[model samples]
Target: MQALRKYGDPEYWNKRYSTASGTFDWYFEYHPFIAQILDGFNSKEISILDVGCGNSKFSEILVSKGYKKITCIDYSKAFFEHLFQEFHERLPSVHYMYMDARMLSFPEASFDVVFDKGLLDSALTGELSYVNAKQIIKSCLRVLKPFGKYIIISHSDMETRKEHFLDPSFDCELRCESIVVTDNDCHEGEERLPDLTFYAYIFSKHLH
Candidate 1:
């Protein structure tokens, strides 16, 4: 928590997203690891909330796959506006909201699936990385139904260790389901070169 007090703030993330110079601006569409995780589940009527979902192309994919309830949240209004303008009418099933992932105001056990694509990693980039990560995770857990899944795509190996800390609070098992090392030359010679290997963690709520 002290780390977030030192660095993880809305301004920091907003600025990071606002800059076109950052790698985030050149993020790839449809996270493969998240797609794999979702493939493992068989439920049809799933409620999914994608945290820090900046210009998420994943929403379009989900809509094409017939997902009815989809919500995406991002802290930056500018990014959200760009996303909305691009996809608002194209995919009406997607509900976009502007809010900090750490301070989500939703009822407990509200969603069937909570997926994050590098949201926690962005929070952890600053000094209060750990605290911000925890805050987001807690909010995710709060909004996840019992036995629901919390999927996170993080660049750091510490997410597994951090999950142990959250076990006491949420009674869930955080398992590292997959690691996708992408050399997707989709943007060859682009200004931003993707260098990180993303790890997908699936945190399943333990039913009593």
Candidate 2:
């Protein structure tokens, strides 16, 4: 964490995805949790935003699933441009915005569903970890309508931080809907890291 605090900034993430040197691949799309959340929604004209929506492939999936209103935001211009160029013509219905998740400029109660895949995890590594998390949650809450759902897929540590971020006025619930365990050393050629577990949290906004 200390090491990440020293250098993990927007530039760090931008560079990670900019050159393909990092672990992320353009082919990676929405995770299982995203599909689960989408499956639970019955609304046809729901307002949705994918924070740190890398590559927009997930947004494309939402389009295929018949979601008419969708928007994606990311801080990396290179990545956003790459996704835009790849899918703009194919899925013109979805809008792409270049912005930081921690500082969103949208009206209160604007979106019915808000999803964050790995953005919070990425931001939780830097010097501004706490501040970033707080700001992102605050902005997200401001834009999320009453009775809306906020879905987050994060590392176990970040999942634990959700309680601290939730406001006292809002009644929140945390559930580990699924767990992903990756096998280490599956490939015969080289040694690999230990298994990683991701926790999915579903936050529901309570209305009066």
Candidate 3:
């Protein structure tokens, strides 16, 4: 586990994406589950911010699904270059920027949706994980417009990893949903690999 702890480091991600070939979403990309996960909100016109977006084609897929005004941020310059090159002309609606999730440069109430797929989990792997994660969360809340949504897809359970989001100061309605990802090898009702469970923590800000 010590070796994997480096995931929290920006340099680690820089190195990782430097040689990366194709897209990589931390867990699952936008597919059978992404549409279902996003169906609850049901608005393609709203502005979306995808934090720590890495090389994931999730944002691209969202564009294909008819959602415009998507901004993706990552601390890794490598990812910014790759993502920009891959979609700049193809999908001009999606913007890629090099920025840290913990200190978003955008003004407050800038977006309608703030989404993170596996950034918090990566931060949780390093030292002062809680501090970093909370900083990111606070920024997410601050930059969201009233009644905006903060969606986090993580492997962490609610009992431990997500209880911190309930501090009242966050001012959001918290809900947890579980998604079961079965192995692809399961053929015609046969189970092969153990089920992998991922949690989606949705935070909808209160209008003041």
Candidate 4:
């Protein structure tokens, strides 16, 4: 599992991003759909938390559409510092914090939506794959508003992802939608990179 473990290592990502060239987005094409899903909330001014916010333009797109309260966090020193500087000049309103998904610092029920692209997938690569992923999900659940949506996009299948997110203890209802990837540029970092499609697993926190 050493290969899997590498994906969770901050140092591994630091070195990789250091050598990466132009904008290499794993979920480059998911922007429109992500925005579309968020729009389902029926409000542009909702407080949104983006976990493992890589160099993806998800938050920027939302800002363009008038999403004012966007907060993004990442543990990678490389990604955090680079995006923090870049967003400061551009998206001054979007909060970019250097934080780990497993231990979110935000107060309970602080955000209307908690969006994740591949944080859980990456965390599942560590030695404590299940524990890491569970912790991340728990933290996301804690910070979500009642009936808030936790949208996660990943290449993992139902069997792999459901067990982590489908627990009754999570106190959320789950619905999944299939996304057919048309782009030829599949992200090599993904475990299920061979497939031409991925999944968006959405967990809606209970309305209690």
Top lDDT: which candidate number? 3
The best-first sequence of candidates by TM-score reads 3, 4, 2, 1
**Judged by lDDT against the true structure, how good is candidate 2?**
0.71
- Per-model TM-score, in order, reads 0.76, 0.78, 0.89, 0.86
Local accuracy of candidate 4 as per-residue lDDT tens digits, 1-208? 6667898877888877555533345655455567677878899889999898877677777788889999999888877545457666678898988898999999999998998887788888877889988899999989999978888888888986778877888878898887776645557775555446778888887776
TM-score of 1: 0.76
Q: What is the lDDT of every predicted structure here? A: 0.71, 0.71, 0.83, 0.80
Q: Poorest 10 consecutive residues of model 1 by lDDT?
A: 19-28
Better of 3 and 4 by lDDT: 3
What lDDT tens digits, residue by residue, belong to model 2 across residues 9-32? 767656655664222422235566
Scored against the true structure, residue 11 in model 4 reaches a CA lDDT of 87
Highest TM-score: which candidate? 3
lDDT of 1 at 162: 64
Clashes of each: 2, 0, 0, 0
Q: lDDT, candidate 3, residue 33? A: 57
Distance from true location, Cα of 113 in model 1, Å: 0.9
lDDT of 4: 0.80
Could you tell me how far off, in angstroms, the CA of residue 187 lies in candidate 1 after the best superposition? Answer: 12
Stretches of candidate 4 above 4 Å error? 19-23, 184-195
